[model samples]
Target: MADPRGLATLPPIRGRVQQAAPLAPFTWFRVGGPAEWLVRPADMDDLLLLLRDLPDQVPLAVIGAASNLIIRDGGVRGVVLRLAGKGFGDIVLEDDGIIAGAAALDAVVAEHAAAAGLAGLEFLSGIPGAVGGAVAMNAGAYGAEVKDVLDWAEVATPRGLLRLTAAEFGFAYRKAVLPTRGVVARARFRARPGQPAAIAVRMAEIRAAREATQPVRARTGGSTFKNPPGEKAWALVDVAGCRGLVRGGAQVSEKHTNFLLNLGSATAADIEGLGEEVRARVLASSGITLEWEIQRIGEVMP
Candidate 1:
């Protein structure tokens, strides 16, 4: 599925590169078109090189483990970077904290921390996506957020690498004001020593609670909309009669109204359109407009 525009102008790298790569298979919703050019760098050095050398005119985006993300129908243009493999997925314990690569799964990191008797990161067990996405956005769940435990994060901007402390991130509700074209390469999270058994019990409770409340087995992105100032998004959705609402092959989860399911046959447009419909309904039912928590990227088909 290589395109004629090709990889000639792109810098050579040790990692894999694919043109017109299908993205739906890896994403949570399992619907979307190909990436125009998908680059998976072999290591930090490879990624930094690509970031520093990539042409400024070329559009760049990092899609880590594609949770809480929707890739639209017409596909993403230019380069899409996905961090994974041995180089990017490693997790190491150091100084009562963990240094997790951008590709490390949030749950995996939580497990690693629990094994080492690290207490503070148990909340990550219930969050979706990778360490990089968690850091990029101030990902939180079950009463804790990235900002609470992060010591520092290493980011690769087009200019090069910069390790910013937690205060430097300027994190707010579910977001951060990072440098332009910044790709979070890795992050160090501080933790305190705790009883491993207690940490295990806490992690288990969070996991069980999440599984019982959310559609963990469904083809759905987690948390469709953010909780408004002092209100809950799901409650607003339920009050608006959006529970089990369907659009094409997309349906609001019966288990949790905030989640929209792919139902095996949804297109990216179907999923996103359903979300917009939910937002519109919520707005009409209540004066408050729901803000999207799941990120919609790529392009929409006409």
Candidate 2:
């Protein structure tokens, strides 16, 4: 069946727009149906215009690296805006800070910061998403988070572009209270000076640690569930005996209990079903209901 939503209804913009764009290729999970509309804005100005001119009735969603997302099989039914790396991937080094574009990979940003002798952002090397996603979720690993170094972030809201401070974001464990319709454009981080060699060594250590503990080479989402307060999620999952548990082609990662893997030919339903099963078992066994760390979007197939 042809899509009922017409592209002609959208405002003209200097970017690529597609109707019924396949979303699976954009995510780590590699499962899901097409997006109703996918818009990749050429630059910040282009993005702003789209946001400002887009009708109030039309919903909009912004995706960064798509590292920590799960688009449902039924697909997303709105404009999915992505910032193209060519225009939104700059990394600028300041005397005491680093400014990174929303599309800049987190690992690349860490590497750039290290080359500039910045110390505090080494933790970003271990995170898989881009800077915007990191800021949106307060992404963290190995004892540090985006909130620790983020001085401010530039966001495009329906009203206009604005610079928001870390405090204003109301950051919490694995989350940030950003505007519902805002799109993170770029971010500034404050870092102290250190020897480049030392920063590189720290990043290397982080990489080695993650490689050893995570299913880095598999088709998987990073972490499935958030750790309950004072409790490690992986340990709880292990205790619940969900390690290596399989449903259809999805399995709890044998290497890491919290990581869910799609062992080839897994549907989005299979993976999501397996996760819910884990949560149910964990809740029954430990009485601590786990919250999801990875963001699941779109609708389920009828």
Candidate 3:
């Protein structure tokens, strides 16, 4: 069977669409293949139209900042959407809450909140991804998670758009149960007025702590695996002797054993392979199978 929904046969879209777009530059690791079809939507309405009109067989994936992702070697099979621009990067202070577009960087959201004298979102300053990814994964750091602050999120579904409350998402440790192909458009996070100086201090401390413990300047995906219940992933990686382990041009960050880095010119295959190897070693050494925190997608090169 062939793809029935090629770009030539698609409905009209106001956004820019490319047949194949290089995705390596979109991610932090910078070692993936291209997106078979890349669509940069103009705004939330444009995305909703695309989602509603596209055939169900046409696989849909959205990338926002692309911080903790792995696109496979063979490239994505269908449409890849990158929500950007003022359409999706807008942030506004609304009473006791912050309304952030999906493409709004987590750090930016935190800074905005801090500047507005809102507290409880300082933890977001340490998360490297965007609001959409954070909502998708319930992304957390230090002590708080997205579930703790998310009031509701507007998601573009195949049928139309929906505003789902935080309780609707079955959020867990580093995971969230969402619709099969839901694309988060924007979200409202509950916050309370606090001292601006205190919030700034907290954000600064988190930033410094991250720099001291993690390879913040390196081209690496944040954390490779989620810490198992009552167990740390980095400690297990260290015990398995996977720290600084290398496969092709990919190496586990010695500074932070849980991080996988592309030592320039590495293929996505090498990075994925190294991650599998780490999982094997950790399992063998501790009888605990570490689950990936990073989302891996697309196909292996044939």
Candidate 4:
């Protein structure tokens, strides 16, 4: 399929937008088709111009590090917005807080904050997504979530840019109350003083734990399902005899039953279908339906 508008003709703004961009390279799964148009804006102003000028009917999808995403086989239509190095990857240290660009890697932010003697964000050291995705999904590890430390955020809505206070985000378990069509530009998190060496030790521990319990090196979309109240999704999955289960090249991670792995040659459908099977099996076995925590998007190929 060809892009009718030919994105290259849009006359060189500060940003570079591409046509028919392969999405696999951008996601953790390493599977999926191309994006109709992929735009990497240079900065907030550039992004704003692209967004405002985009036709109302043209759909928009923003992705961060793509650690928890699975773009389908047929690809994404309209515009797929991704922030580039200069545009949205800065990590700044403020007196009592850290302001991170939405595209900054969670681990990078954690490392920089720890170096600056900022404590309480060590949990982010283990998460492998961008700041925006972390906020959107309330990404967490070791019992701490993004919502817990966030003081406020810089967001861009359809109407205009605004600073959103912590309370305004209406943070909840695994969710943020962002506007339906809004984009997170940056976030501010407050932290306390702590020894940099001590924070590094904590971060190392988190890394080791993740390595031992998860398929961190494998092509996976992190945790597959949210835990049901009073019961862990992994426990139920193991009880249902789903650990090490495989459907084609997709398998339930033997290290962590909550994770689904793409064994080199898996397709998006294979991964998604396996996830669905896991949900069904858990529901049938434990009478509790499992909800996917991973973000599944794009289209299925015929």
Candidate 5:
């Protein structure tokens, strides 16, 4: 089905807007179809205005970095907003914390934080998403999570712009409870002073560790499944004999069982199918089901 809303009826804004924009290039999977309406707002005000004036019946979605997403073959309906880094990727160091725009890459944040001698945000270096996606999913790595250091966040909600405290987010493993349609605009995180040299060393260690264990260079969605309580997802998949398991052009990463990789020509269906296959096999073997950590959006082709 095509997008039901007419772009002509939408409010004017200072941004780049397109109809039937290809979404594959925006995502890590390098697969999927197009977005019915793709809007890259020039700034937060532009985004807010667009959100406030958008038709309620017309769905809205936001994608950042697209590091952990799988867009389906049939494409997404309605307006899909992508915050450009040039406008939303600023990082400011405060007296006691760091403020980052939603579009700032996590690694960049980590590097900046280290340069400013800020500790405790070093874990962000290992996360492959932008600040918005990190907050949306409560993205974590190496025992630290966004919730642990987040002071507050500015979000664009239907009611208007609102400042939400960390506690209000109701964070959980790999998830954050946010307004049904809220868009994170910026976030401020609390950090403490530390030696820049020490912070850099820690960040470097994290990078090395990640590179050694993950298929960081492959066209793959980071982690395919969340670790079930008390059990590692990779171990479960490995025990299920799913390591290197293949479906179409997609395969479970031999380097990391929790990751699913696209071997050159995998479609969205192939990648998702491989994940489901891994989930099924894992469940059948361990009686514990694996939950997908990757956000699979859009619709399947008919």
Candidate 6:
């Protein structure tokens, strides 16, 4: 997928760009195919340059921690961007808020914020995705969501760099609508002073609760379906007689019915197919449709 003409003319930068790289190692499921081209920009400047100069016809997509994504077995075409190292891994504490880069892990941000005697961000400790993904998904747990603390965000739009406040994000439960012109570079979160040790204890409790209820140890995306209003998805799956149900190597987790586990050898198709079957069963029995939490990307083999 490399452009020979552009490759020669484009001045070399400090970033590393690879062609036809396998994406399995970067995703949580440890499955899926390769990316046509992968770019790890040196920093925000490097990212902007690449975005500006790249051909408009070439496809592009960005991934954060990839905790809730499926890239399919056939792989993704064109350029796939992943920020890493110094460029997108910073966490800074200010007198008023915290500034976290796009690639910074949620747990890392949560821990640092707690250590700084900050409240309101403890809920992030249990989320496993990156900060950008959390914002994009409006990720929440334990009665708290990211929107509650988001002060502003820095995004690299097609027009240029822009700052968006909480109101500009138009956040809803588990969803945030960006400008559609570019990607989020970082976010600033507001917090209030709290006891550091007490906050740490609360975070520990959240972590323990997550480990107890979720298939965190299994090879699976966090939750297969979003909860429908007042009811939980797990309860619905269980009542529909799909608990512990197996299709190929994929099983609806007995530990947590909402989570589907890849039992050692499950293919992407197997996992996805089983999820669909569960959704169908739940809909037939309960008369309510379950929406997928995991975002499926790329195409299936023909």
Candidate 3 local lDDT, 137-207, one digit each (tens): 99999999999999999999878889999999989998887787889999999999999999988999999
Worst 10 residues of 3 by lDDT: 2-11
Q: List residue ranges in candidate 1 displaced over 4 A.
A: 1-7
The better candidate by lDDT, 5 or 6, is 5
- Each candidate's TM vs. the true structure? 0.97, 0.97, 0.97, 0.95, 0.97, 0.94
Q: Candidate 4: where is the Cα deviation over 4 Å?
A: 1-12
Candidate 2 lDDT over residue span 1-302, tens digit each: 55345445787988999989999988898998888899998998898898888877777777888888888899998799999767799999998989999999999998988988988999999999999999999999999989999999999887899999999999999989877589899999999999998898899999999989999999998999999999999999999999999999899999999999989989899999999999999999999999999888888999
Error of 1 at 288 (Å): 0.7
Which residue pairs in candidate 1 collide? none
Task: List clashing residue pairs in candidate 6.
Answer: none
Q: How close is candidate 4 to the true structure, as a TM-score?
A: 0.95
> Who is ahead in TM-score, 1 or 4?
1
The runs of at least 3 residues in candidate 5 whose Cα sits more than 4 Å from the true structure, single-residue gaps closed, are 1-7
lDDT of 6 by residue, 1-302 (tens): 75653543332556988878888788887777788878888998887777777766667778888888877888887778888888888999986679999899999999998888988899988888998888888888888989999998888765667899989889987889887547788999998899888898999999999999898988888878999999999999999999999998889999999888888887777888899999999999999999999877766867
lDDT (C-alpha, whole model) for all candidates: 0.92, 0.90, 0.91, 0.87, 0.92, 0.85
Model 6 misplacement above 4 A: 1-13
Tell me the tens digit of each residue's lDDT in model 4 across 46-124.
8777766666667789888999999999999878988768678899998788999999989999998898898999999
